[model samples]
Target: MNHLKLVFIILCSISLVTSCASERSDDDGIEPLNTSESYEELNISYGNDDEQVFDLYLPANRTADTKTIILVHGGGWTSGDKTDMTDFKNFIKDQMPSYAVVNINYRLADENNSPYPMQINDITSVINYLKNNEAHYTISNNLGLVGVSAGAHLSLLWSYGFDTENQVRMVCSIVGPTNFTDPAYLNNTNAVLQELLDTFGIDTATDFLEEVSPYHKATATSPPTILFYGGEDPLIPITQGTTMRDKLESLNVTHQFTLYPNEGHGWTGLNLLDTTLELKIFIETYL
Candidate 1:
């Protein structure tokens, strides 16, 4: 009887400790999570960089034929992290429970590290990781990319500029800076123009800017894409999305564009819903 009592006491102690630790989040006066979605933290590095890490969000119920998507966060290729989009990723996972979404942190630019290669290299590493781990997730190699702001530019340029093997299946650019040569942007009398060029300048006489611009690199064979932008986005002029859509149309590439006359940078309510639905449809069609 003594031995049995000791064992019972030990088990009870463990249970209490577990319960206390589990309640830590709520100890700060928070409620329980309404929905449960499982996520895994992963470390990916090209070299010996300590900050090279990413997070992958997987639906709790694994899909038999899982689809994959890679998310690139926007900070003009100069700043940002994978965790910035957790809320959005959660929203997506709730809506489509069969897709595995990846949020990535790419190396940012400095004097030595130009945008020419680092951004695309980070994306390529992510694709390679997915391709290798497809079996683990039970997902197909069919992939898509979506980005906001600077992330939008990266998504478009990488999808259109990169070859199909490293390419995304479908791309959605949320107010992306597409055509650098647009009359609105090319002729904007604002400091934003100079700030953009100042970041990518090899010299005044170089064509490297064009090389990185999606509009300059677009081809008829580019993958299907959906683009969204506000009519009044100050950072990105109207011509950016419209001109790119024009090019895609002329080339017969599959594409769609949505413009909200009263929104900016981002959207809310119906416009946001419309954009999200369009993206859901686009990915469903491809992935």
Candidate 2:
């Protein structure tokens, strides 16, 4: 494995193994700490409830008027934990201290099953959970979502189509696949890559494929959006971002689309930091 992917895998694994640790305040759920003026309780629930649950983090200094940020972790929709994304959540919290951060975990897919409505359904439940206890968290009905890759796909779909609370004001997607029908996927040239992608082969089924495609479900009413993609994202072609950007413009939803022409599935140093900064600033414009 390449250096970065190896590191990402290690970090993700460490977070997952430690996910069940007793909850902590401002510490990765795996660690412990005394509550302070800036950090408070880290309320968590098994998003699966009857099964393995996930965790949630809310800032103590926030108020009901404060806009919250819901973050989704990406591992090809099959292997990620909310606690794994604690790094991203804490980064945002440190930058925008007042914004409450809600990270989530959803079901994964393997040989026997493809993760489908399972994760989306869990997303719906999380939204409901947040609203039911919104008063206690001091987060407002106004919310924003940020996701990377597979998580990006979920954030966009949930905000655009099934936001039951109608609370998602903005969403940011980083290197998320917009069109599953791309030639690279539909007419895949790499045999090994194709096999890995089509293992579940749901895209061959019409309604089923659309069932998970964010672009297929986008409408004029979708919330304002910001997108960032590296020009060389192998799983997601440049056409994906362009087509979506064109569609959003047609729908006239406030949106911004950015591309790092030299980058790929993920970004690095300066571009990464800049993209994150942009999200913070752009979210403020709407939230």
Candidate 3:
């Protein structure tokens, strides 16, 4: 499977799914708004760093009660920009117009700077900035996180462990790594996977690994989560999703897990459609 082609197909499917899903209304007490006055602010800096900026999209007729969805992209925590999530941001803006969208860019990790607490801190800063300026943005503190790969790992880690105020109502992970300490990772011989793990310092103490692993950080009170994975993914093994699912179940946390058996690190076509619909429903139910 050509990776680029697969990504294109995924994006196309998302656009189609968003178009189809937008026509349906739910009796879940939330009504879709019809307006043409949405707001968008790009390169809003939450910190001094160059990468500490995010793009905000405020829906038309939004209020302080309006919820938020934050998008985090994936590039092994060392690369990737906010633009990588443009498709998702647009999908949310069009399909879930009542909700606000934030696509963020965090400092990429390098040999001199590790990804752990730093990238995690960036997420915290983004949330703090949002809450501090809630009245200005006219959005609620309630949040839904949607991340892919490394971004997904960060979303799970923060929502499960670092969310002190319980602001995150729901989170969705697409091909995200959940457990750094999972044997699938620790024992895998894949150089690319190992290189990515090295950014977190593979030689570190076991406790530290557990500290960063969402599988270990999740508790009964953790927010509802939905996860998607591919059975044949070269970077993230099947255990990454299944283990987290099992952990969520053991803790009695509300969660959903979907696995595409023949796909790789990412997927497209009907599976992507299913993922988008499932994610949309989960957000409606929990966020």
Residues 186-265 of candidate 1 have per-residue lDDT tens digits of 34353433443443444322265466678888888888989998887656777888888998999998999999988777
lDDT agreement of model 3 with the native: 0.78
lDDT ranking, high to low: 3, 2, 1
Question: lDDT for every model?
Answer: 0.66, 0.68, 0.78
User: Candidate 1 or 2, higher lDDT?
Assistant: 2
lDDT of 2 by residue, 141-201 (tens): 7888888877787898888878866789999988776765555445544443344444453
Q: Score every model by TM-score.
A: 0.77, 0.81, 0.84
Better of 1 and 3 by lDDT: 3
Q: Which candidate has the top score in TM-score? A: 3
Query: Which segments of model 1 are wrong by more than 4 Å?
Result: 1-39, 42-47, 60-64, 189-206
The residue-by-residue lDDT of candidate 3 on 64-106, one tens digit each, is 7999999998877777788878878877777888999999999
Query: Backbone clashes per model, in order?
Result: 0, 4, 0
TM-score of model 1 (CA atoms): 0.77
